[model samples]
Target: MASQIQYADVEVGTELPAASFPVTRATLVQYAGASGDFNPIHWNEKFAKGVGLPDVIAHGMFTMAEAIRVVTDWVGDPGAVVEYGVRFTRPVVVPNDDRGGLIEVTAKVAAKLDDNRVRVDLTAMSAGQKVLGMSRAVVELA
Candidate 1:
């Protein structure tokens, strides 16, 4: 386990070390297997493109889950997360070829919500467009 981040250490408007998680068809399929979210739009590019999207779309929850790695890693434990939510602002399209569409996720401490908690705002992008936005979470510190 990593060293615990003390509550006194964080300040309002501080930024967390950002992270990036790439998305691909295989990852979407793997996530579907592990998370039980096997939406066709996540893995089937043809089906997605047929429906008018640029390509296969990553699952909304899948994107959120990957982005949480940055927060949980920074906070040093998953248990530190009090609440997390994100509005699906855009679909993260995964290209069919190898390497797929890479999602870049950056986060910052938006505010000190309470004595032991801070609100973290996240932004995820892919293909030079916003894939996830208005993403916020509350984390408790030791």
Candidate 2:
């Protein structure tokens, strides 16, 4: 599918819609099962805390995927993304609670590239702490 977003309509500093993802213990468990990443740190609070983490944490890949929804949602086509990468800066601690953890993502057009493409920079935060660093995606626009 072609991107609904047009390159001519975007600017270097334009902001895309922000997104928030709710991540609970159940969410982590589901992701673990789906990805075959049944790591103790992601599902066992005791194991996580024993390893010096505050609590069971979300998987890095799951967090990365959640963060990029902002870009995919904005572009209106998931395949429009040509490249995406991020550095894991901190863990999204998921405590055993009703509220759980929230991943807040905000993105902006970092640059207007050639060939109907644009670079989007993303910031992902959880528990008021930045979890992903240098998060960026190169997306093709119609």
Candidate 3:
């Protein structure tokens, strides 16, 4: 299938719409169950604090997936993403409050490649700190 977004319309440095994902303790639990990553650092606050973390943290993979929503939402096809990766720079701390925390994601086209593909650079932040660095996605567009 072709991407809903035409590669011709996407220019270098074009910013995609930003999105914020709420990461609650409950969200972590559900993700743990779905992904089978039942690590205590993602759920147990005491354990997380014991490890010198500020509080319970969201899973790295979860944060990565959340960050890519900006690209997937813009491209309108998950399969259009040919490659994606990121470096976990900081933990996304999740408070036990009703609001929990927010993972704010923003992405921009960094380069246009051959074969209708574009390299998207992404930034994921939480609590005023950069959580994901060097985040990027290579997508095949129409």
Candidate 4:
């Protein structure tokens, strides 16, 4: 797919628009069913606490997907993302409530690379704490 972003216009240290994703208990349940990861820590608060977790936690993969939307949305094509990676620094405790939790993501173009590519650095935070560390993506621009 062709990228919506033009490589000639991209600049190092350009900040993309920030985005936020809500993580509810139901979200975790649906993700578990879809991913076949029936981990109790992601759905059962009691089991999560018993396992030494603060509460029911959102799946790391789910969080990663949510964070990358900032990049994909900006590039306007999922295929534009040629490489992506992140370190799970903290658990996003999704409380069993209507409000649940919110994951806030902010990203900036870190560097312009050869072959019409750029490195984007991402920051993911929840509940006033950083949840993902060293999150970065390489995208090919049109």
Candidate 5:
């Protein structure tokens, strides 16, 4: 296993290896089942369209979870992340039939903090749309 990244030695503009994950209908259903957030909009097409959604959509949290995996994977430990947040600049707009696939995560070191922590900025996109999750992560490295 890769050791926790040592934070103090990091530099500005450092780029982390990118990661891509797919969000399919089955995965969304699984997430819905696991999270107990079985809102109709997440799985019901008619309901989503009624609410003006193009189709069923994945939960924002789900995308966020996938986005964070990129950092945790690069850092070698998800527990190393001390702070993380993002702004939902755009909706996933998952199709009630099929949510788009290939949610890719690309990240770079935006800033470095004291005490072995560094800020990571990320851009995530899927279906050719900017899904602004995994926006930032501050990790404590060994």
Candidate 6:
């Protein structure tokens, strides 16, 4: 699918709308079941703390997926993204509470490429700490 956004209309440094995703204990369990990442660190608080984490944490892949929503939403097509990558810098600590943890993502066009593509840089933060570093996506625009 082609992106709703046009490459000709986009400019470097244009900010995409920011998005936030809530990560609860149930969310982690569901992600674990779907991704087959039944690591204790993602569900068991005691296990996570025993391993030096503050508490139960969200899966790294789950956090990365959530962060990319900003770019996908802006472009209006998931298939428009040709490349995406991120370095896991910190864990998203999901507390066993009603409030849980919020993953906040913001993205901007970093570079315009040939063939109607643009590079979007993303920042993902959770609990006031950056969780994903060097996060970027290359999208084919209309």
**TM-scores of the models, in the given order?**
0.92, 0.98, 0.98, 0.98, 0.89, 0.98
Candidate 4 on 23-61: residue-level lDDT in tens?
999899999999999989999888999999999999999
Q: After the best TM-score superposition of candidate 6, give how far the Cα of residue 3 lies from its true spot, in angstroms.
A: 0.8
Where model 5 places Cα greater than 4 Å from the true spot, the runs are 1-3, 96-99
Candidate 5 residue 37 Cα shift, in angstroms, is: 0.9
Model 6: colliding residue pairs: none
Comparison by lDDT, 2 against 3, better one: 2
TM-score, structure 3 vs. true? 0.98
Cα lDDT for residue 53, model 3?
93
- Kindly report which residue stretches of model 4 are placed more than 4 angstroms away from their true locations once superposed: none
Evaluate all candidate structures by whole-model CA lDDT and list the values in order: 0.84, 0.95, 0.94, 0.95, 0.81, 0.93
* Residue 23, model 1, lDDT: 80
TM-score of 6: 0.98
Error of 6 at 40 (Å): 0.8
Question: The CA-based lDDT of model 4 is what?
Answer: 0.95
* Candidate 5 positional error at 23, Å: 0.8
> What is the overall TM-score of model 1 with all chains considered together?
0.92
Worst 10-residue lDDT window, candidate 1 = 1-10
lDDT for residue 19 in candidate 2, whole number 0-100: 95
Provide the lDDT at 11 for model 5.
89
Cα lDDT of model 1 by residue, 22-87, tens digit? 887888899899999887888887888888988888898888898888899897889888889888
- Deviation from truth (RMSD, Å), model 6: 0.7
Q: Give the C-alpha miss distance for residue 75 in model 3, angstroms.
A: 0.8
Task: Report the lDDT tens digits of candidate 5 across residue range 90-111.
Answer: 6676653453566788899998
Residue 26 in candidate 5 has what lDDT? 78
